[model samples]
Target: MRKKRGIVKRRETGIKYEISRKNLHYEKALDEIIRIFETENYRDRTINDYRRNWREFFKIIGKENVFDVTREDFRKYIRQRMQMDGLAAGTVNIRLGGVKSIFSRLVKEGILTENPGKDIPKLRTDEKPIFAFSDRQLKRLFSIIDKTSVAGYRDYVAMITMLYCGLRANEIENLEISDIDFDNSVIMLPGSKNKNRKIRAVPMNRKVREELRQLIIENQENFGEDVTHVFLTTFGEPIHHGLIRKRMHKYGKDAGLIDEARVSPHSLRHTFAIRYLKNGGDIRTLQMILGHSDITTTQVYLRYNNDDIIEQYNKATENDDLNL
Candidate 1:
């Protein structure tokens, strides 16, 4: 009887130890999910977003034992996020995507048998049309910038680069003096947001060329030979996205352009695409210029009105012999 009682106690202790080990395994898996993004070389901004979303999730569910989380738990959490926090559908969906990614990683590593976040339906969001500055808006915006000042000159060149070349804000910030091809009147973008990651050359118009030339000359005068980047801040450091955004907003407000819609660095790129299409630039060429991997991605930049549609229809039917 004594031996049998000892045997039973040993079995209970073994089962408890196993359960504890399993719980730790689940917790470690959660940590690995966060670690995988960094190991995969995701962009810094993307990693930060993932970290924030995961932290929010862990706060609600607790950090340990993610394996026991159910699909219904995710639904409740999303509802709470929407109703309690007043997050928009798009914002909720972004957070949901991050959560789903974590589960997917765990499943791939065999830590979880299933991805609970996978089956949860994402919130619907209406796609807003891309906003671009009109010609009048552009003129007013430029007029507000103090062109004589050094900071103004740098901002002006940066604006022209994005407007003419359709470069992203980060791309503009990262540009170096070596990227400019003065002899060929082109700027070489060595890195882009495209998946293919191919180097692209953007041909500069006379106006763009002149502005870039002046920027280079001024940069050389101020920063000497070792400074590599084309754009710089007032303190001679490389330009950052935050400063660019602040300046753009200030100028927009001053010009009265901020009342209707927010003017951002991306608006210049959108303006470039709209103007390029209006001026007879083809979709395929615009795709290459914009560094888009797919022509469909470039099509979003083409905004058509009823007048534009009617004009095209009239032009096409002009060659027809139908008298009516």
Candidate 2:
């Protein structure tokens, strides 16, 4: 007969465990997590995002073993990230999500008995009000773009597509000539940011159709059927997302928009959503237009104020004052 091992009881939760320690290396665990992301068909951009957040977390923990990280350690890491790095609550929450994903994978693979990040609470983040360009600002932005030059005309068309159809920068950059159904007055997006990865068909308004025709004419004249992407650089290559962001910022600044509000490519989407709502577009329809899987995501863009409500009410009761 052999001597029995004593059980260890955790003081915090009163949970009993056998005296056993697992040796799972942190780096190896992270590598496996990345492999899992790849197996799940996560986009390269999304994988890079997870890698960035997890690398930062590993640096903070300074541990080589995955099982060495305790719940307290995770809590302390969150506090350090917020206080020392001056990261906002929302940003920290995203980082926490990455950590949780890593630990969850490790647990699922039998590398760890429990996930330390499972009980880690996400920080409360105050939702920032949506920033959108007003009609005057939109006019100012369009007026500043010199439409005669090739790059200028490309940027103009790109901005107009985003403003009317709410296409993301990547969607616009990856757009092919075949995606535009000129006969049906619609633009087809094969891959969007939504979870389902379903194809989205957006209606082409007059402005979008006009700019698209112009872009097609310009592309035909310049590339002569060599390029496939709708938005191309001066070299006829597909435009990178970073350049589109920088161009949007430059145009926003030239139009005298506030820099603190982050008036960039995404602001055009916000502008489109708000304008659509104000012009009597329903939330359900806006959801479909924005390619959002959840209607709650679209609702975040609906920022109506009391003044707007009063204006609508006054318009409705304009002839029924009754002089009370």
Candidate 3:
């Protein structure tokens, strides 16, 4: 009876099981991929990223085996991703890369005969040239920030550290009380975006250091010494990027600093790079200071030099009296 019904029946236990063709294909590829993520054997979230891609790919392919997906299907996926207007180019690339990786893994496991995305070109998401502030502008901006006020002091120190140290918003958000090393004049950046474990030793400028010390003292008196966040919101929670950005806009308005481009928390880092370069700092040095894995990224600071050069050129040619 079991043989006629296409069921695998154990002779001793009399247990019968039927495996559908689609189920067999899914078991061979999709189930194993899911298991890889659930097991946590892959420590990175890369597995989860791939799994998400697989889920979306499967939904689109609809019961088609890994071997059945053609290049046309791959192109369609890319089109779908591009149509997501709110998604950044960087994020789209990540998702696309995730999809390619899954197919490559399937090919390695012999579940897929060929990777459809093997020859497909990767998406380009190279951002525009960075725009940072000048040293004079930075100093001027800080001059207007009153450190006597509690929130003002925090804002001043936060901006200074971010600009000077080139720390990312998320990295700054994760700072702990123990991370600061006043004796060494550095603050350790833990779990950075680059996944580097080494401590980023940033030189604590005197003014910034003094403000940070007073802020800590005040916090300790109010919330005690055990509190973790270096910068806090009014309710004493950790400061968010949104709030910091709002404060920056307000300060910019107050300082009469006008630029057509919109500024955000990330602008401070760019400002630091330009200021460092303007001060005659080398590109390699700036790269290390900014925690950039690639030197090419540090090269973007050169664009800011053009503005200074143009200013100088204007002054040099203006007095020549070429108005004839």
Candidate that scores best on lDDT:
2
Assess each prediction's global lDDT (C-alpha) against the native: 0.78, 0.80, 0.69
Total clashes in model 2, counting residue pairs 3 or more apart in sequence or in different chains: 0
Clashes of each: 0, 0, 2
lDDT of 3 at 56: 82
Q: Where does candidate 2 stray beyond 4 Å?
A: 1-21, 192-196, 259-261, 305-307, 310-324
Question: lDDT by residue for model 3 over 220-292, one digit each (tens)?
Answer: 7767777788888666778775777788778877777756433556888887778778878889878877777
Clashing residue pairs in candidate 3 are: 132-271, 133-271
The total number of steric clashes, by the backbone 3 Å criterion, in model 1 comes to: 0
TM-score for each candidate, following the candidate numbering? 0.83, 0.86, 0.74
What would the per-residue lDDT of candidate 1 be over residues 1-324, giving only the tens digit for each residue?
Answer: 443212111231121113333453343554566566667777778777777787788677654567567887787778789898898899899898987887787677665569888888888898767878877889889998887999999999999889998888878888888999989999888754333568988888989889988988888888787888989987778987677878899999998888875699989988888888888899998999888888888987665433477899999989999776
When 1 and 3 are scored with TM-score, the better candidate is 1
Candidate 1 wrong stretches, greater than 4 Å: 1-21, 24-27, 192-197, 304-324
